[model samples]
Each structure stands twice: as C-alpha cells, then as structure tokens.
Target chain A: MKNLLKHHETYVLLVIIIFSAIITVINPRFLTLENFFDVVKSYSFIGILAVGVTFVLISGGIDISFTAVATVAQYVMAVMIIRYGGNIFTAFLLAAAVGISLGLINATLIYFFNIPTIITTIATLNIYYGILIVISGGKWIYALPGWFRAFADIRLFTLCTDEGIKYGLSIITSIWILVVIIAWVILRYTKLGRGIYAMGGSMNAARRAGFNIFRTQMFVYSFTGLMAGLAGLVQALLVQTVAPNSIVGKELDVIAAVVLGGASLAGGVGTLFGTILGVTLIAIMSNGMTLMRVSSFWYNVFIGLIIILSVAFSAYQRRTKAKRAIAVEVE
Target chain B: MRSRHSELIILGCITTAIFALMWVFNPNQFLRIGNLQNMAFQLPELGLLSLAMMVTMLTGGINLSIIATANLSGIVTALILTAMINPDAPPPGSGGIIILAICAGLLTAMLIGLLNGILVAVIDVSPILATLGMMILVNGLTIVITKGYVISGLPNAVRFIGNGVVLGIPMGTIIFALCAGIMALILNLTVLGFNIYMVGSNPTASNFAGVNNTAVLIKTYIISGLYAGIAAMIMISRFNSAKAGYGESYLLVTILASVLGGTSAAGGFGKVSGLVMSLIILQIASSGFNLLGVSAFLTIAFWGFIIILVMVVNFISAKVLERKAA
Candidate 1:
C-alpha cells in the first residue's frame, strides 16, 4: 500500500478523481459522456504534443521550438492541400516530412554546435516563426478543402441520449490515444526507450554504457517534430483555419501539462499515464471553470498555482524520502 | 579576465562594423539626430530587460516572468496614477503622488519576485518552471485588472521620465546608463555578486565554501524584479499607457542579447560590459534595419541567425583553443 501510494501516477490519478468529483458535484452535467468526449476531443492536439514532449523531457533535453515546428508544418500542409488538391495522406506526409526536417535542424544545431538544447530551440523558434511570417505575410489559411474538414467529423462509436443529441468519440481523440499507446510501447519495450531513460538519468553514465548519444538525441527531437506536425494538422482540422502565430506561445501549456503529469524538467522521470492524467486534469479544469461561470481571466492564475503546488509537493516528498532513507541506514 | 576582455573587444568591433555598415547603406538617414534619439529612446527598455534576465542567468536560473512583472508593475502604477489624479482637475498630480505610485509599482514587482524566489530557492522548484508559472499568474492578474484594455492618459510628470531629455541625452538612456553602471558595480564589487557567480558555476562547491545559495538566489531574483520594475516605469512613461501584453516580443531578444554578449546559458561567467556592448549592437542593427526599410519580420529572422552564428563561432574557437593547448 505504501509503495503504491508512493508512486507519482497514484497521486496524479487521485487528483484527477478528486477534482473531477468536485466539478461534477458543482455541475452534474460535467459527468456526462458528451462533455467527456467534448473535453477529450478539444484537447487531443495538446495531448499529442504533450506525449511527444514527454519523450524529449525523458531524454533529458528540452525543446521549446516544437510549437513553431507545428505552426510551420501545418501552414505548409494547408498551403499545399489548398494549392494542389492533395488528400489526407498527402497532408500527413507533408506535415511529417516538414516536421522531421525541422526537428533534425534542431538536433544538428545542438549536436554539432554544442549549444544547449533550450538555447538552440529558442533561437530556432524565432527563426522558424520569423521565416513563416515573412513568407506567409501573416495571412490566415482559410477555405480548406471539404475532405480535410470532413476527416475531423469521423467518429469511432456513436451514442444517443434521450434528449436526442448524438455524441461519439472523435477521430482526433482516437489519434491522441493511438499516439499515447505508441509512446508507451516505445518507452516500455524498446532499446531506444531504455537508452533515453538512461541518458536522461545521467548522460555520462549512459555514454559509458555504450548508448549512441547522437542517434538517441536525433531520434528524440525528430520524433517530437513529427508529433508537432501531426498536432498542427489536427489543429487545422479542428479549427478549419491555420493562423501563423496562433500556435507558438502555447508551448508553455503543453510543458505544464507534461510537468504536472510527473515529468521532471531536470530529466529522466515521467510516465505516459501521468502525462494523460495531466492533460485531462488541465482540460477539465479549464472546461469546468467555464461550466462554473468563473472569470476566464483567472484561468492562468489557477494553472500557475497548480503547477507550482504539484512540483513543490513532489520535491518535498522526494526530500523527505531521501532523509528517511538516510536515517534508516544510520539506524 | 583575459577572455572577458577579448570578448568585449570582439563585441565592440562587431557593433562598430554594424554601425558603419548602417551608415554606409543609408548615410543620410542613419545618422540623423532624430533617428539617433529614437534609437536611444528604444534601447533602454530592452537594455533594462536584458539586465534583468542576465542577473538571474548569472545564478544559472532564468526569470521568464520579467516581461509579466514589467507589465504588471506598469499596470499598478497606471492604476495608481489614474486613481489619484484626475486628468480634468487642477494641479495635474503632485510629486508625492507620483512617487507613491512609482513605489507601489516597484513594490508589486518585488513581491512577485519574492514569490519566485521562495518557489525556486526554498521550495527547490526549477527556475524555468517556477518563473513560467509566475509569468502566467501575473499575466492573468494583469488581465483581470485591466479587463484587456489599455490604461492611458498619464500625468506629464510621469511621462517625463520616459520621454524627457537631460542635457542632450534622452532621460530613458540616462537612466539606463545609471542602472547599468550600478549593475556592473554590483556584479563586480559586491560580495553578493561574487556569491551569485559562485553559486551559478557550481552550487555544491559554493555551498561547501559556506555560501548560502538560497539567499543569494532569492536576492538575485529580487534584484531582477527591481530591474523589471524600472523597465516598467520607462515603458509606461514612454507609451503614455499601460496594458497587459506590452513588450511581449522583447522576452526572447533579451536572452539573445545575453548569450551574444558571452553569457553562457548554463550559468556563471558573464560581464556587464559585454552585455551592454551586445545590446548596443542589437539596437543599432534594429534601428539600422528600420532606416533601411527592411521588413520587421526579416529583422527578427536576422536576430535569430546572428545568435546561432555567435554560438557556433564561440564553440569552434573553444575547440581550436583546446587543440592548441594539447
């Protein structure tokens, strides 16, 4: 029981349950399947990005340029589809390719130039966004093809309520779930996944263990780039428009969700389960606040408090645990 | 010390080169007093912000909340100014009232900094996450107070600090110089400054040497907050208005300037003179681009390229030096 309670995911799950209970109590409507689908569908893109970022964070590197990569990827995909009449497969391919290349740019800069990950990403974030803005002239890509818009409406399962409203699990939400499952498999079973954890835990130790640092980093960043591209496509489909600057500043939200899910920014400790819970908690919190009729302005304040509190709680827990172990050894 | 000197000299040469190039490209427009003063007026806001970022980075941490703190401080001052003085009434505003407003604004920024310090230093939260949270919280508060509207119509006295000239120099530039000089002294001559570098470079060694890392970090962030507060005053005074989202773009530029000036991102090892030199270089390039009618977006792209180029140059030079030593 104690070991189970000590797990970070346990605490995250507990918070989700308690918070959901509170929200449901305040507004019973929040308990419905419809709202559940709504929240998950709407936040699926963030979920995808969070999952991708979890890999990088677990590899002990930070990437802030993912959002910029997403923006550029989605913009290019949208432009191509609108200009040349490509299908969904073409869209995904274009976004993924663009994302991979951009991600490689980040990796190369960090590897060859020996620049810090955060610094390289920050510089690249500006470069990518500036180039996009210069080329696109800050124009919004509208009038997307009907087929692309139709893809968003596909649902896996359908349910009908007595009130005659039909709701189903959205394709975007399924995509998020698929991404999560894939990431879990990669982290749990793959050698590359183990290498990522080892590297994040201690880079020198991992290097001594014969793990290819360069290949691991290349894979990590490029994977994130690929995810960002997909997320961008998901975003464009959901919104039905692509705005040049809409996606860049929200990098913090995704980072917060990942961190809140028990991913340490210091690197090497996080879980896919915790990340999903974190994303859910954030989505529900925002959604519930809207249901509760709270001022929208207070949203950031609450998120900030939650992030600080959770991280502080975990830090305190770790310190106490270390002290207890030390005392035990002395005894 | 030798490396620091060389870094500054190299930065100086680069700044001079950029300046000469701007003059050569647009000889008539680049050197006009009006344009010069305009650049002078603009340089201080970013300069002060870079200093704010540098102090914390010196301790191996970053204060992402600097822009938020500035905006919040500016809002508080604007709220006070607007509340205490009526625009249509006689005796526009008293000196005491203005001073009170300024103090209140600074106080707000300091309190936010204190929160950041406690979270980062005492609570052991990472600096990036802590400040990022503070940034969001403070921004939310700014929005709630301002309701997403601009607070305009400030008294002339307050505006003077941002727009007034002092003996051929803009008041903003003069103030920036004073602050930069004091900052240089703090980093060079004070025990706290020494401790900051020690803690940043290696916290374990510093702690074993009897330096209080927590206190130094807290003090460092508070000082960073104070700089942000000063920046707020200049920003509000110059714009004659305050808003929740002012100067959002300056956040990244401040980091760019710091790194270009030779501050390592991993912390420990930066010089105020180097930062100042880099800031001048950026301002000149920025202003020069404006004079040359280069697209603003392209200028941003240029800044990004310059940062990468600087880092690459530094890396290659370090490697060459290492080989020579071997």
Candidate 2:
C-alpha cells in the first residue's frame, strides 16, 4: 500500500475519490451513475486531445494549433455533410486528411525553421482559425444530418435503476479509452516513442544517439493533428452543430489538464494514466461546480488556481526528490 | 542591435508600401481626414497592449493575461464609477469618485501582476502557464462580478480618455505616445531596464554577475500589468462600457505586433520604435482591408502570415550576415 502511494497516479486517484466523496456529500445528485457517465462522455473530447498532446509534451514541444486544426477539420466535415451531401465515412476520412496536412504544416515549419515551437504553433493557430472563419463566412453550421448526430449511440452496457435506465458505457467513452490504451502501448513498446522521450530529455543527446529529430517531430505533431480531427468529429456529433469559434481557445484547458496530470511543461515526462486522471479531475470539477449551482465564471477562477497549485506542487516534489538524491550521493 | 535597426527599417518600408498601395487604390477615402483620425483612434488600444506584451518579452517571458487584465481593470473601474454615482443625477460632481475608481482599478491590475510575478519568479512556474492561469482566473472573476453583462453609462472622464482629442490629435494616441516614450526612456536609461535585458539574454550568466534576476522578473511583470491597467483605462473610456469578454481577439494581435516589431520569442531583444512601426503597419493594413471590402477576419490570417514572413526575412538576413563575416 505504501509502495503504491509512491506513484503519482495513486495519489491522483486518492484525490479524485476524496473530491468526489466531498461533492457527493454536499450534493447527492452528483453521485448518480448517470452523472458519472455524463462526465466521462462530456470530457471524452478533451481526453482524446490530451492523449495526443501527451506525446507532443513528452517530445519536448507544444502545439496550440491543434484546436484550430480541429476547428477547421470539423467545419469541413460539417460543410461536406450539409452542403455536399457527403457520407459519414467520407467526412471522417477527409477531416482526418485535412487535419494531418494542417499538423504537417506545424511540424514542418518548426522542424525546418528551428523556431520555438510555441510561437510557431501560435502563428499556425491564428492562420488556421482565421482561414476557417473566412472560408465559412464566420457562420455556424446547425443543420447536421440526423445520422451523424446519432452515429455513436451504441451502448456498451445499460443498467436499470430505481430512478431510471442509465448507460454504464458509451461508444464515445470507449473510443477515448481505446486511444489511451493504444497510446500507452506505443509509449511503452515502440522505438519511436522512446526516441521522443530522448529528444525531449536532451536534443543534442538524442541527435548524438542517432535519433532522427525531424521524423520524430513530424510524427508527434501529425499524431496530435490526427487526434484533434477525430475529437472534433466526436464533438460535432455530440453537439449536433459546429461553432467555429467555440473550439479555438480550449487548448488552454487541454494543456492545463495534461500538466495537471503530472506532465511537465518543460518536457520529458507524462503518462496516459496521469492524463486520464487529470482530465477526469477537470471534468469532475466542472460538473461539481454546475451541480452546486455556483456561477460558471467562478469555475474558471477555480480552474486557474488549480492549475497553478498543481504545477507548483509537482515542481516542489521534483525539487525535494532531487535534493534527496544529492544527499544520498553525499553520504 | 544592427539587426534591430534593420528590422525597424523593414517595418517602416512595409508600412509606407502599404500606405502607398492603399492610396493608389482609393486615394480620396484612404487619405481623408476622418479616416486618418479613425485610424489614429484605432491604433492606441492595440498599441498599448502590444507595448505591454513587449515589456514581458524583454524578460524572455510572456503575459498571456494582458487582455484579461485590461478587461478586469476596466470592469473594476466601471463598477466603482457606476456604484458611486446616483442614476438620477446627470454627471454629478464625481471627479473624486472617478479618480478613486481609476486608482482602484490600477491597484487591482498591479496586484494581479504581482501574483503572476510571484508565480513565475518565486514559485518557478513556466511564464506561459502562470500567466495563462492568471488570465482565466481574472476573466472568470470579471465575469462573475459583472454577471456577464456590459457596464455602460461611464463618467465623462472616460470619454475624454477614450475619445477626446487635443490639438487635432486623439487623446488615446497621446496617451499611447506618452507611455511609449516613457517606456523607451526606461528601457534605454534605467538600471531596471538594463537588468531586464541582461537577465533575458542569459539568466545564469546574469546571476553569476550578481544581478537580481528574480527582482528583475517581478518588476517586468508588474510593469506589464500596469500597462494593461493603462490600456484598460483607454479601452473602457473609448467604448463607453466594460465587459469581461471585450477585446477577446486582441490577445493574438498584441503578440503579433510585438513579434513583428522585432521582439524575439526566445527573448533579450526588442525595440519600442520597432513595435510602434509594426502597430502602424498592422493598423494601416487593417484599415486598408476594410476599405477594399475584404473580410476583417482575413486580417488575422495575414497577421499570422506576416510573422512567418518576418521570421523568414530575419533568417535570410542573418544567413547573409554570417556569410559576409566568414
């Protein structure tokens, strides 16, 4: 038990349980299985982005452009559906392709130019978002086809309770989980994954070790783009509309969640399980706030504070660990 | 420094070229007095925000919360102004109230800035994450306080700051110029300014040289926050209202302007004159776009493109300089 406590994930799990327990005590409605599923389903989109972003962060880069890329891809998907009578499969394929291309734009620019990743991505974010707005005439697409909206209605399991029937699982949630598992395996087993860690840890060392920096960066960004595209589709289907402006600025939330899950912004660290916990914590906080009838604005305030505190706590942990290691070496 | 001067010249050329092109396309309207005045008025808010961005960038950091800080300060001042004034009274003797409100608003901004400085300098959080948190926190606080409603019917003083003109020049522009001039003096002459550049250039080296790096960083962010406060004053008065989400789009443009003005993202390099020129170039481009019936949204894409273009130009110039040296 004490050994398990040494893991950051275990501590995160404990925090989640305690937080949920407190919220449940205050508002029992939050404890319902229905609400649990709702939280998981609602956060699934962010979860998918977080999964890909974990790779980028671990590889020692950041991509603020994913949200913009996702926005453009989703807009295209919507346009094709409503304007051109495109099928679901065609829309997904096209969106994924567009997303990959957009991701390549970011990867190639950063790789070739050797510019700072943050500035490069910020520039791309604006360009992609602005282009989408101009192309779409800044109009919201509302009339999505019925099939697309209802595309993910498959329930993994259903439970009948005294109150009502509730689905224990959803296809959307399953997709998120599947991605997480796949990403976990890739990070743990693949050479490219290990290469990413080496690159992020030290660029010169990684290059000296014969790790291809350009290819690794290209793969990292493209992977993020691909995930953003898939998440965008899920978001549109879930909401039944595509508001171009809505998705552009939420990259902060994803970054915050990834960082909160024990990922260092400085790179060379992060995990799939840690990211899941982070996403869940954020989702639960929002859900709890809504359930408590608190003003939504306060929600952002709390999130901001939580992000600062979480990052600070982790930094402190790393510092103490370093100090302990030094003390042992001295002895 | 040579590169900085060349960047400024390049920006000047770009601005003039755009102006000439616009004048040729529509000379009468583009050079009309009314349009010129309007452009002067439009330049300051973005100019001030960009200035604020440059200050932090000089320390090799960024304050993403500038827009949010501006909004929150404006909202605080608005709340004070509206709460103190009797609704039935028309612009009553409330000069003192206006002064008090402005102070409160500026104080609020400074406090927020101090929090950001502490987080980044003391707690050692990444500047991006720290400022991003502050942005969201303050934005949320502003929204909660205002209930997502716009606060209007500001005092006459706001009109003077926002829209008033003296000797045919806009008050906002005057304020921006004064602030920019003061900032230039500080950067060029003050010890703090020298420290900022040194720390930004190389923190470890500066520390070894006995420079107070943390103090410099804290001071830099505080100055940035104070600039945001000043900008809030201009913005609130100009719009005759305040809201939490107003100027939501200015954040990116401010960064764009700063970068275009020759502020390096990796830090230790920027110029006030360069930033001023960049602001003029963007403002003219935007005004020209409006005149040409181009979608205003497209300008954002242009701004993004311009950053990349400037970087490319800088890269080429650096390469040429290297070859010449070799």
Candidate 3:
C-alpha cells in the first residue's frame, strides 16, 4: 500500500522538487511573492477543474467534453458581457448553466445508450466545440464590460514597505486559494467524497451495495462542468479577451496534470492535495520555461516527454495493483 | 435486428433532410458542379480518418492522431517537393515533380502509421494512449521540420492532380470516390476485412476463435496511415502549397462522420460505404452553412447539433425497435 501511494503521486512531487531546485538555481524570480500570486490566480482555474475531474475519473467515468462545455461558457459569457448587457455575476451563472447542460447531455447519452464514458465524452467534445463554432460564426469577442474585471480584484498579502503598499495579492488570487482549500476539505474529510473513492474502485460492487450510480455520475459530471464554467470566467479575467479558440485542446494538459498529480487515469485513486501540487508543478514548468526563454523549439518536446513518462508510470502502478489483486484472489 | 438499424434509418433521414435543405434553400448554389467539386476534394481526409476511427472503435480503441498524421504527411511532401524537385530553378513539368513528392509524403505517413500500429498492437498499450503519444510525436515532428512555416511550391502535375479533374471531373472527387469504393470493397468482400471487424467488435471471442488480434490491429493502423498520406497529397495538390494547419481541423469531423454515418463506436458493425456517404453529408452541411454566410465559428454548434440529432434519432429508433421486438 505504501509502495502504491509512493508510485501514484511520487512523479508529481519529484517534478515539483526538480523544477523548484532548477528554477531556484537558474533564477530566483520564480520564488518571488508577486510572481507566486500571479501563478496562483492563473492556476486556480485549472486547479479547480482538475479537482472535480479527479472525482469523476476516480469513479471510473471519463469526461472529455468539459473543454467543450467550458468553451460554450466562454462563448456565451463573451457574447453576454459584450452584447447582451450581462454582468459578471449573471455571466458566471449562465456559464454554469451551459456547463451543467453539456454535462447532462453527456450523462444522458451514457445512460440512454449504455455507451462507455470515454466514447460519450469524446462525441460530446465535438458537439460542444461544434456548437461554439456555429454560435460565434468564427468571430472573436473582446471588450467585456468593466464589472467583469472586478472578478480579478481579490487582493491579499501585500508585499510593500512602510512607504508604499505596492505589491499585494489580488482578490482573485485569494478566492482561488480559498476555493482550493475548500475543495481539499470537501474531498478529503467528507463522507460523500469517500463514496466517490468507493464507487470509482468498482462500479458493479458499488451498485450491488446499493450505490446510486446515476446520481453520482450526474453530480460528478455537473460538478466538473461547473468548474469548467468557473475556469472560463477566470480565463476571461486572466487573458482579458474572450478567445474562442484559446483553450480548445487544453483538456489534455488538465488530464496530464491530474495524472501527474498522483491521480489515476484508471480511477478509484487520487487526492485533492496531490492535484494542487500537480497543477503548481505544471505552472512552474511552463512559467519557468518561458522565463528562461527555453528554446521554443524544445519546450513542447520537453513537456510532452515528461507528461508521457508520468502517465506511463501511473499505468504501471495500476497494473501492479491488478496483479496483486489477482494474487490475493489466488491465495 | 430492426432495433439495430435504428441508427442507420435516422442517419438516412437526416442525410435526406440535409439534401432537401440544400435543394430548398438555394438549389442553384447547393446543387452546382463547383460546389460538388468543393465537397469531393474536401471530404477525402474526413473519409480516411473515419476509417481509421472505425478500426480503433472496432477494437475498443480510439486514435486521436489521425489529423496529426495527415498534417505531418502534407507538410513533409510539400517541403520535399519545394526543396528537392526544384531547388535551383523552375522545372518545365511540375506535374512530374509533384508525383515524386506525393510518393514521398504517402510513404512517410505510412511509416508513421507503422509506428502507431507497433505501439498499440505489440506494446499492449491502450489504443487511446498509444495514439495520443503518436499524435504529440507527429505534431512535434512537423513543427521540427517546418519550424511552423507554410510550404509552397509543388510540381504542376501534383497541383493539377489537386485542382484538375479527369476531363471535366476534378481529380480530387475521383480520388476520394475511388478510395471509398476500394474501402467498401475490401471491408465487405475480404477475409482480412472480416478479421478486422471481428477483432474490433469482440477481441476476446475472436481470440478464442483463433483470430490474430494484434496483426489485425497493426494492419488497420498502417492502412489508416496510408490513407492519411493519400489525403495529404490531395490537400497539398489542391492548395498548391501545404498550409500550416492543414489536417488539424479534420479529426473531429472525421470521427463525427463515422458515428453519424451509423458505424457503432462499439466496433463490429459498421459500413465503409455508409461512412463515405456521411462524409459527403457533413461537407454539404458545412458548405451549405458557409454559403449562407453564417458565422462559421458556430460550426462547432452545428456539429453539436448533428451529434445530438444523431443520438436522439438513434435513441428513438432503439425505442421503436424494442417496442416492435416486444
């Protein structure tokens, strides 16, 4: 068991340590308070989404459509804040609605046809992206309303001398920090959360034990959708321009992060804390790589190599567990 | 048995409705030689990718690398043609120059396909994971070779193949039709095709019955790769220059065509002919929208609509079939 846990999240931690040591030696700007704040805010969007996806994945259900759902949220919000006189609050709600709707569509397809979760989500990914394309007519919407900018205002922990409070954390950063904490708490110390672990381990066993698979799947998918919606809003603030194509193929990174963070792509394993660490590690790699001006040429290759190795290691761990289980049964 | 055909009937109905929409809205523009030609050239990649998808789906695997493979081949062919064929001066016959380029591009893609097949079939990796790795690798390879630049300057012959038809018929249309025809024949008529279908639909049962599942899988990947190469040749010749993002937009559309055309993602039951038809239908829907001057960004939404409609139709058909069975 200890061996398994070590293998699960060990890669993410090693990456974090390796990058931290390298970046610190290479440049100290990586450890600065200001840069750290920016990283927190930027990663919160991905971090939160990863948390929800972790839950769904652990339950052995995959949701590839979240990126599409998030795209829908962004498109709607882009149109609303720009055209329909929608405020940040209203836009957020609408984004969430769009997310939940897409999620429901995925759940419906899976249940109605007994389709595999991966296939269902794959089909819906196109559906969501396709819908976005149709609605936007391949146009980009910029110039969101001013109130939408207020979402970025959450500031905390200023780094300033007695003379001037020049470097303080933003409200957005604080909110992201708070949300990550809350997510960790709800996932680790809650009964329903434990149910997720139970369910992901074995669907048939969970069902035979009278677990409500539909409700769990519906909730998990909707929750992931909501996270995607929230991520969309954060994305809007971070980039300050609504890019329809900005995050099209980002789910791969998210899945990579979750898997890197010690969450199993095979399900029934993962933790909130590990996910945050994984997200932070990726952030550092991307941010530091950019800061160092690593050859734009080798950057993707480097990152892709790490991601492949990390996931391959995760699969190896799962296989060991499977073999062990079989051995136990034989015994 | 009737329930099984529910997806087919719905797909047929939707296809007919699209045909009607084109005829009703702007029959002149919709039913034009030029438009038909546009679709014929435009759909080969989608058709080829769908076949690739069918292989993976049959084996309970999915390859997300189809576009990457296609794009990689396109760029490589373009690069070779421009650099090798006419490095110093303009050649009198560009057609011959391009033919050599096409051969190189298709061969390279097939080589990549061979890699994908080995990774999935021999390594025992999940099809999704195996192809995902290949996708990143190919995309990287493309970026590495091209440095993310568009390649122009193909032999005239190649360009002619893309733009010209066999005496009033565009070569693109003929090539695409020939591909579909060949695929349909091989899939329905040959034992190799039967083995592929068998492996994809029920690996365990097929294994017990002595089917060589790994060999079947490897063949499918190679075939898909070869198709990607062929599709790239068509695309490059048509454009006269290999664009930077040629095959990126094709994966989803191809997968959609396969599903919407009534190939079960579950595997054993799919028809290449149906997939080919569905590719044409997709082309028509998008082209029809483009003609209407609708914001093409909503192409995603349109596809979403198609998928949902396909699903709902499939759902209703299944229900009706069940009722009839009852």
Tens-digit lDDT track of model 3 for B20-109: 997788867988988877777666656766776765665656777777788888997888787867644666776566677778888888
Listed in order, the DockQ scores are 0.78, 0.64, 0.34
TM-score of each: 0.97, 0.95, 0.88
Q: What is the lDDT of candidate 2?
A: 0.86
Q: Candidate 2 DockQ score? A: 0.64
For B123-213, candidate 2 gives per-residue lDDT tens digits of: 8878888898788788888888998899988867667998999999999999999999999999989999898999889998899999999
Residue by residue across A127-156, what tens digits does model 3's lDDT show? 678666755665777777777776666466
lDDT of each: 0.91, 0.86, 0.73
Runs of candidate 1 with Cα error greater than 4 angstroms are A326-331, B90-93
User: Residue B254's C-alpha lDDT in candidate 1?
Assistant: 93
Clashing pairs in 1: none
Candidate closest to the true structure, highest DockQ: 1
Better of 1 and 2 by lDDT: 1
Tell me the tens digit of each residue's lDDT in model 1 across A250-285. 887799899989988889899888999889889988
